[model samples]
Target chain A: MPEITFRQAIHDALVEEMRRDSSVFLIGEDIGTYGGAFGVTAGILDEFGRDRVWETPISEETIVGSAVGAAIVGMKPIAEIMFMDFLTLVLDPLANQAAKVRYMFGGKATVPMVVRMPSGSGTGAAAHHSQSLETILMHIPGLKVVAPSTPYDAKGLLLSAIRDPNPVCFVEHKLLYKTKGEVPNGEYTIPLGVADIKREGTDLTIVTSEIMVHKSLSAAEDVSKEGISVEILDPRTLLPLDVDTITNSVMKTGRLLVVHEAVKTAGWAGEIMASVSESPAWDYLDAPMRRLTGKDVPIPYNRFLERAAVPQEEDIVREIQAIVSNQY
Target chain B: MGSNKINAAYDNEETTDARKKAAELGLTNEDLVSMYEVMVEIRHFEEMATTLYGLGKVHGTMHLSIGQEAVAAGAGFTLQDKDYLINHHRGHGHFIASGADVNKMMAEFLGKETGFCHGRGGSMHIADVTANNLGAQGIVAAQIAMAPGVGIAIKMRKTDQVALVIFGDGAANRGVFLESLNMSSIWDLPVVYLCENNHYGMSAEVGRVSGKVPFKDRAEALGIPGYFIDGNDVLAVYEFMKNAFSHARSGSGPVFVETETYRILGHSKSDRNLYRTKDEINQWKEKDPIIRFRDLLLEADIITVKQVDEIEKKMAKVIEDAVEFAENSPEPNIEDVMEWVYA
Candidate 1:
């Protein structure tokens, strides 16, 4: 096993897949000479040359449309938008085109492609550059949305996403790029729609993903000192969500707290909350399910305002404290 | 980030040599007659689909490539089995011209289970993977963007196969079309861009949509070899497209072509001929590619009156059989609606 950064793990996955299959290729803006806006593809161009590591024009729609076309014709294309916010330009491609091709074409076509982007708020990137838009993508019926929290998960999920027969929106947290964790050197794939239980607990279950996974785990660790056992679960893939894991966790703990970095209004946490409520876990709830997510406002550039916009470790701890205490 | 209008003008382009190029390209009497036969099949199919739409047999009106059959017949002749094709919603003409099964297409259009897409996708979403006809797209310019990607696959796989996408003039105005041209140019991908400028983008004339810059000239501005041709002349389209395909196949990069054609019918079944005069329709009808090719073949002794009559008669029967196949076919089961959604 090798300890590597989240970015390195993703880079390794791409390199391994491209080497393993010739049909797999990379397309994006500034992904070649500039090595991507975040330098995730720093040396990919040198390794694969311009053929495989294509630096496309500043055309998000075309980039995605081209990937959809390539994917339907047996080529596995991974098209990277610089930031998840820019994915707004790709809605037609994602929602209207890629998501429906397999079904609308009556099983005649399969768009096996990855629309990858850096997501979430941190580093004061302001409103337009920073956004956790997994909820928006998750609403799309045909796409598989993945948000990995650790280097190990990043590598494993990226590999699985590339191999998936359907389109995947691989959302990497911008802040997690440099975060390091243990990753196996050889091949490994963590299947999509499976949740990872980071820290098991008996008193409460905290379901989250991406950067929020770290926040939830830290909150769980802090609350453990007070003899409160908190469970931190990450549903690595969003669309084909692992409801079984979330429900089982809620049934055991009898309390559910869903957290995410997206806006609280229609965020993915609500989907998790709703799913659990509809399942057998609904009767086992000792307390009302609560969500600690980003506020319903555009992310501000001010460090303090940005911090207040999304849930932090302190915010998670405070919310969980309120849930366990059954007091204000 | 900027725009520069090119020096190319559609008005100044050379007129097509329908007869001379037919000889130069070794288009035999059989080849020319075959092109005519495909066009006849398309025309008959469109007329029948229109009747079906009128009878409420086909839901969600279909777009027809009625008078634009030359573009289909010619370009279809240029595509090899391994090459890829992306078509506009009005692509039934190209589908027939490209040698796709008429029975499957009719069944799909009629919403029958035996359709090309198992009836999930109706008239607007037909795709035949075995023929490498990727799929027909309903969106205007969005479909053109796929060619470069398919071209990328061809280039990366070290194959001589080429990819071609046919769109209307209305679609060429979109940013995706220009972006595809620019991307294809920079990468020198093996792709061909074809624009059938049928003079209207769903009633808004092409002039209003694209400010009169010939579609091919816009492609030329992107560093691709651009040509403006008579789309109604199947010989011209065939000659020009053959060059474009071989050019791309030889790794010379993409070629953008604009074929000046007309759609004699309304854009879709819902359209009435309110936007244009009947006289204008009559004039384009006079220049109808089918009649022109038929007359050319007849005069040149390439095809006899009997041969032309035989093709027309055969096309009517083919379409009639297709209609029968669709009429009796079963609809998809409700329980399997979600089947084949995700692999």
Candidate 2:
């Protein structure tokens, strides 16, 4: 195992996949000489040459639509939307075209394409560049949505997404790009519908993903000082949700909490809770299920306001403390 | 002025002159006959489809390309099975032109299991990938954005195959159309952007929407060669498409072509024929591609009037058999609704 930044892990996964499969190519804005907006594709042009690394104009719709077209004809295209907020401009290609092509064509066509969107607010990019829109993608039936929390999961999950027979939306949080974690140096892949229990506990269970996984872990450490044990679970892929893992954890702890960086209303938090309540875990609950998520407001440029918009370590800790104390 | 130039090039009704022009384009007697047969096939398919719609046998609205048979036949006859075609919503003619199986197309329209999309796509989304006929899209400009990617795929595979994308005049105003042309031009991708300018896009006339600018200017601005051809003349469209496909296959980048044609029917089943006058529709009917090409072949003695009648009879039988196949085919199993959502 080698420690690598989440960004390096993603770059490594792309390099490995492109080397292994000739059909795999990267197309997006500034992906060639400019090396992508976040530099995830930095220096990849030198190795793969101009054909595989295409620098496109600022046309999000055509970029994703062309990826769908290329993917249909036996090419694996990984398109970048530059920012998750811009995914609005590409909904027709991503949701209507790429997501539905396989089923619409009676399985005669497959869009093996991955749309990588850099998401979340933390670096003061304001409302336009900062958004946790993975929930929007999850609503589409044919699309697979993945949000990884660590470098290892980022590399492995991305590999699986690239090879998945259908369209996959890979959401990378801007703040998590530089976070370091142990990642295997060789080829590896984590299955899409699996959940990872970041830490084991006995009193309570917390389900979360992306940047919130780190916040939940820190919150668990803080709650432990108050004689409360908390389990943290990250459902890496949101669409094919791992209900069994989530329910099993809830059954053992007899308490559950869902945390995410997305907005509160109509978010994955409520969906996860609904799934758990419908499962066998409903009878095992000793406490009501709770959610800690971003407030319903646009992310502001002010650092304090941005931090207040989403869940922080302290917010997660406070939520755990309140739930344990029967504060509802 | 531009329309007059293009019309004059194909206004020659002389039998010998038409044969000479066809020969100049390397079209033999068999090719001409096959071309005429395909045009007749499209005309019959559309007319029958309209009848089926009237009888409430076909579900969902369908956009008919009744008067645009020559555009479909000329381009469809020019393409190889390995070449790709991206079609728009009003694409039954385009699909038939690209060698799609009539049985499957009719089955899909009738919502049967044996259809190309297992009855999932219905009239607007028929696709025959095995024949390289990428599915027709319901979205107005969706195919335009996706066509350049097919060109990219061909370029990547180092295949000489070119992607011939067909859209309506209305699609030219979309941003993705411009974006695709720019991308294909800069990358030197093998693509032919064909705009079937059938006067009106839905109720909005092309004259009102596109103004005085020719459709070719859309591509010419991007450094791609643009051509305006008389779409009602099958020979003219066939000859121009031949040069365009070759130029694209030569890796000279994409070419844009606008076929000046008309739609004798309304835009869709929902249209009431309220936008244009009946006189306008009748005027377009006089220049019918199928009748014009048949007259040319008959006068040239390239084919007998008896032969032309036989093609109409044979195509009528083909359409009848297709309807029977669809009527007897099973509906998709409801239990398998979850199937094919992914690979």
Model 2 reaches what TM-score against the true structure? Answer: 0.97
lDDT of each: 0.88, 0.89
lDDT of 1 by residue, B1-343 (tens): 1122222444322324445657788877677778889999999999999888878888677888889999999999999888898888889988898889999999999888999999988899899866798888877777877777888888888999989899987888787887889989998988899888888888977665566557666777789999988888888788789999989999999998888889888988678878889998999999999988888777777788988888989999999999999999999999998898688
Q: TM-score of every model?
A: 0.96, 0.97
lDDT of 1 at A274: 94
Worst 10 residues of 2 chain A by lDDT: A101-110
Cα deviation at B237, candidate 1, in Å, is 1.0
Per-candidate chain B TM: 0.94, 0.95
lDDT of 2 at A150: 98
lDDT of 2 by residue, B1-343 (tens): 1242222233223233667987798888998998888888888888889899889898788888999999998899888888998889899998887788899999999889999999888899999877788899989999999987898889989989999999988898899988899999899999999899898889987776664446787688899998887889888888788889999998888888888899899888789988889998998899888888888888888999899899999999988899999989999999989888888
List the TM-score for candidate 1's chain B.
0.94
Q: Considering only N, C-alpha and C atoms within 3 Å, which residue pairs clash in candidate 2?
A: none
